[model samples]
Target: MAATRQALDWPYPPFEIPAELYAAWDARAHGAAAEAAWQRRFDAYAAAHPALAAAFERRMRGELQPALAAQLPALLDAAAARTDAVATRKASQLALDALAPLVPELFGGSADLTGSNLTNFKGCVIAGRDRWGNHLSYGVREFGMAAIMNGIALHGGYIPYGGTFLTFSDYSRNAIRMAALMKQRVIHVFTHDSIGLGEDGPTHQSVEHVPSLRLIPHLDVWRPADALETLVAWAAALQRRDGPSALCLSRQNLPVVTQRAHADGAARGGYVLRDMAGARAVILATGSEVSIALQAQALLADAGVPTRVVSMPSTTVFDRQDAAYQDAVLPPDMPAVAVEAAHPDFWRKYVGRRGRVVGIDRFGESAPAPALYAHFGLTAAHVADAVRAVLGTGAECAA
Candidate 1:
């Protein structure tokens, strides 16, 4: 009948003569007056409870509590001073432990991987039906956890975050996209971020997840090189109020690369960790691959290549930098090599047409991490070889 009506010259013959229908319309027309009456009552209540009203306003504004802001500097300083090798996930937990107690509004949990993800901090009680707690035990539901975090962010009292393996981000991708679209300040901590998470086989390894997450617009993706970088990344995520963030962390321990005194460069997203005068090539790397790049720079230096190493923890942040800073870090004329354990596609932007990328293009193996790295050719030797190859080609063409 609806289809036949659409085909007819007049789709509908308007007729509303029922007294009940007119009464329903009258009630609907008073909705604006009803809302105004409720607003007047709320205003009276707010005036009677000024302190509660102020707190409510602050939460609605998504402002960090003053106490939390005051403690951030000391926490960042403590994180920078730590020099021991540790997993970035562990570093993130330590930072969370210190900050969560100070910042009551920072709430997070893991998708049944708290021990592996290290997302649960000390003094964090599990949330229950009767009362709210700072931490949530999300069980094994990755998608549910992400959606819940998005809800918390959108509602605006808490800075919501959650954790899962990097490989499983595919499950929570749509929710992450929703948070980005709404410009919510949600954080996603993805551990076991690469083939470095070995012995678990190819099913758990994250070969393309990093690049995949980086592709999302307005979402800050960070693959911190070490404990200090992880701390900095966490601080950055908390400060960012306009977008969501993803922190790609590793299961294996990483050596400290940035010191407390020299850690400011990390805030810029990419920094020259080691520089050489009259450098012929620049080596860019993130996460565990950065240590490999440093080693490769040493090898190239010994071979008279004069290479520089730049640690780029956050490509999204780096892209927002001014053209002059970008050019200074990655000179247009210099031959470059990017070393990452993930896919090679995104590295092309910084490395350029003539440059090379040392990355994994296939699934990982079931062996130990060292063996898997060797099997996939993700090592200082491979990165050095790529650098040498690019420089050699440039030299040959010039000759």
Candidate 2:
């Protein structure tokens, strides 16, 4: 080939370079010049349209919409006052319905699970070609929906979120990682967060999704216990401009356990829900498990164990709190038992060496929610046993 090229005098002093090749070589410069020219035009337009330009700039900075900010306090108050039992997902729907109208930049939809995810709100027009809309129908594309949310966030002027089953977070894991790496404020609504999703089988249940999502740096994972906590989580996710957030919601109804006075404490990620006088041990739990922990506290109190229940909705946020707050919530001197219907490994850090964890390290089985709880030993009885074990009052339970 070399001899043939020499014979043809290819690209040497005897041959000229192709015009197309030269044009191709110059394309980068041309593109740069074009971009500079477009920027200059944009600058001139911005100068002429100062107010619009300022709004655009502010949106890119991820500033909360002024109107939305004004309405947040009252909306949160209303959400906190809700005393009826409701699933966290439904509570999220109510929150979105109330806030979406005020925050025009809040745009989101589910991955073809709108009915189950409860992500769509009233007045959210479907996005279509040649017309802008607030909500997008992501259509059963979990990974695609997450990637697209990242794009929307990176493009600016909108906060984007998407929903899917917590078990399917595996399919969107890489995209979630990218969102975290980019520090985009993309919200992921993961419903049916645990085996409590019931009768869906182990295939549909999320045994480790909560801890898995929590492992990702810069990604805030929240498993709210009740309607008020869910509202606070949603608010925190929207207000978080520097990172992504995962809201782990339950399918079963959760009663409003945290009183209105302490409801806002959800923003702190972990807070004392029920404190008992002369408490020697603390029960830490999240999501549906928080209610179980509360029940366990009552059981322990009846047994003269004197236990406290700490609702830890978001470990990521709690870790960011001051040492004093952390110590106050999970005291060093007091024994603690962490409870969740997922992996136990992550809880070992909060619960000291002597402390026990009430969780299912193995896959779940097909059964009713109550049966699953009994089989998996996730009931208040089990949590109370674990608390007693941690306090050296009883033998260690088989959790």
Candidate 3:
């Protein structure tokens, strides 16, 4: 519907602005520049889409609700505990079970890893054959999965989703970019999101994928911290009507954070958890890294260094908050550390140049995920040490 609303929809002028001339050309774009001229037409094109206008009509009358309006976050924490047991497999079955009635437009599939991706929707009135059921079984074709999802979204009757290993998103990168360019409402569920993929090796572990996905303009990126966080991420994807979103989750069973998930905590991106009475450093993390940061917070407290752990599930949502909100949550002044299994780029903007980040700038290894994590210094102790370095508190955080 928003095929014309995104920046990628801008028409290419007859005279191309060479990519190499970005610096000089950007400087030249004052007011009457070609880019500005192009924007007017793009804006006009956005207004021209008939279905888009209809969607806006709902929003104007308050018919639309924020995607993260309720319970999914808590669902994630609950799921985290279940993942290590037989429950991970069953919860997805339960997801299909719950959606059997209400989410007629809902669709999903696996990238040849049905047993692992855990996204299978059974019982459909329309598809007739269980073979072509509402949910598509995309086999190992990541590109086909994304492109097909784009088509499903463009058709206006469905919210298509698919799953694959986190590292494999690269195979579908072009299709995903097109979805962002088209502003399609598709979801990509990536499992085994880290070195925790274990013996699968560097090619399988998703080290640089987080920032790579974040770099896309219209995509919302999520790395859920627990089972409940996973639910929030899923609900957020369903609620976000304008564009695409991805949920990155662990292959290993990470300990659940709270007794249960809190929906509000999952949607707003970064939320403070386990704060010290007086915090000297703020440790921010997403996905499994949040668990590490939480442990680091406790260890730092025991050593007399007060630290606050921040769980950041979605960067795009957090960026939506006002400056005051961002300041309140991130507080540029606090000594900070950003931790994740992925590359460091995504955290820099949040933590600031002076703040430290415990992340991988390199590829993962073929060894067991736990061994690789310790080998690369990605532990609670490592995150705490980063905080200690920032605080200059003289307390050793290393094990």
Per-prediction TM-score, please? 0.89, 0.89, 0.77
* Tens-place lDDT digits, model 1, residues 1-399: 676757864444567445765786786558888999988987988999988777767777887678777877787788878888999999989978877776667888999998899999888878878978878889899999999999999888889999999999999999999999999999999999998888999999999999989999999999998877888898889889999999999999988877665456677789888999999899999999999998888877776779889999999998999999988988889999999999998899988888999899988889899899888888888888888788873321110
> Highest lDDT: which candidate?
2
Which lDDT value does model 3 have at 27? 65
What's model 1's TM-score? 0.89
For candidate 1, the lDDT comes to 0.87
**What's the distance in Å from true for residue 159, model 3?**
0.9
**What are the lDDT figures for the candidates, one per model?**
0.87, 0.88, 0.75
Order of models, best lDDT first: 2, 1, 3
Worst 10 residues of 3 by lDDT: 83-92
* lDDT per residue as tens, model 3, 1-399: 346536566455646765766666676647568788777875786678856755544533323333423433434444545634322233344545544354546777777876787776567432435455676667789998889889888877667888888899999999999989988888887888888778988878888898989999989988877655666666677777789998776777666664343457657886776677788889998877777888888888888888788888898888987888778877778878999888887788878888888888988889987788899888988888888888776667667
Model 3 misplacement above 4 A: 1-100, 121-132, 259-261
Worst 10 residues of 1 by lDDT: 390-399
**TM-score comparison, 1 vs 3, better candidate:** 1
